[model samples]
Target: MDFDEAGKSLSLEKDEYIELVEFFFPAAEIDINKLMTANEKGDTELASDAAHSLKGAAGNLGFMELSDLARSIEERARNAQVTGLSLKIKELKDKIAIIEEAFEKHKNS
Candidate 1:
């Protein structure tokens, strides 16, 4: 989805919107990686923290799917129900692809 509407809703000019998209992508990518590593290491607290941070940022940027999925993973980690954490991570990866696509789209616009 083009983020023009999301930007408009937030009262962002195109340039500002593009910058925000650019900024979020890199940080979100790092958070995803952190989630993966922490989950692998069985560090639930770390995983929860990473997911929670990413979720809020993603939601702010109108990436609801990513934000909601991250919230699920975060809650699961916090509740000590990380049985399918890998699947959750994979879902995040897929959501990140959509975010990447949005980034490229907005980058060119």
Candidate 2:
């Protein structure tokens, strides 16, 4: 994700960007956790719904990699392709960690 482009396009000042990201972080985390839980329980519909929501939210916040991974997870879950969902969920979690680290760095900067 090119946050520079997103920042400029959104006219996001340092504080404003931080605030926006912070606002979404909790919900994103919760949705991801819920999605994982749903997947574990074999609730494909709920898992897909959560993943889809997370994808849109992450995309809106410029977490492009995370968004893409979430979208893939959602699609695969919707199609009942459970074989790779765990791997994809792990990837999504890793991306989320990256986003969190980036946000912390930006906050300190």
Candidate 3:
């Protein structure tokens, strides 16, 4: 994905961008875990909070699709809509996997 080039084009310092990506990598995992726990415990508020947090972090890293998906999850959680959350979570995980792969490749490059 050429995150370095993307950062340059966006006027973000390379080191700053790398740090942001690193920060998000672990944060996303933690947030996803928390969201799953919240869902299992039927704690909609916590799930919403987790999803909201993920959305902000993803958006900051220019992960527009992830951010959008997170936003939808957050909204659904807030509304007590759990019917499709599982599917959404799976989709989000897949997206994160792709992003992680790109991050790893870019970092090594």
Top-lDDT candidate index: 3
Error of 3 at 58 (Å): 0.6
User: Relative to the unseen true structure, what is the C-alpha lDDT of residue 92 in candidate 2, on a scale of 0 to 100?
Assistant: 85
Candidate 2 versus truth, CA RMSD in Å, comes to: 1.5
Superposed Cα deviation of residue 32, candidate 3 (Å): 0.4
Positional deviation of 66 in candidate 1, in angstroms? Answer: 0.8
Q: Which structure among the candidates has the greatest TM-score?
A: 1
Off by over 4 Å in 2: 1-4
TM-score of each: 0.93, 0.90, 0.92
lDDT of each: 0.89, 0.84, 0.90
- Residues 1-109 of candidate 1 have per-residue lDDT tens digits of 6688889988999789878888998898899899999989999999999999999999998888889999999999999888999998999999799779867876666
Q: How many collisions per candidate?
A: 0, 0, 0
Q: Give the worst 10-residue stretch by lDDT in candidate 2.
A: 1-10
Model 3, 1-109: lDDT tens digits are 6688767876899999898888888899999999999888889999999999999988877888999999999999999999989889889989999999989888888
lDDT of 2 at 6: 72
Error of 2 at 45 (Å): 0.4
Find the number of clashing residue pairs for candidate 3: 0
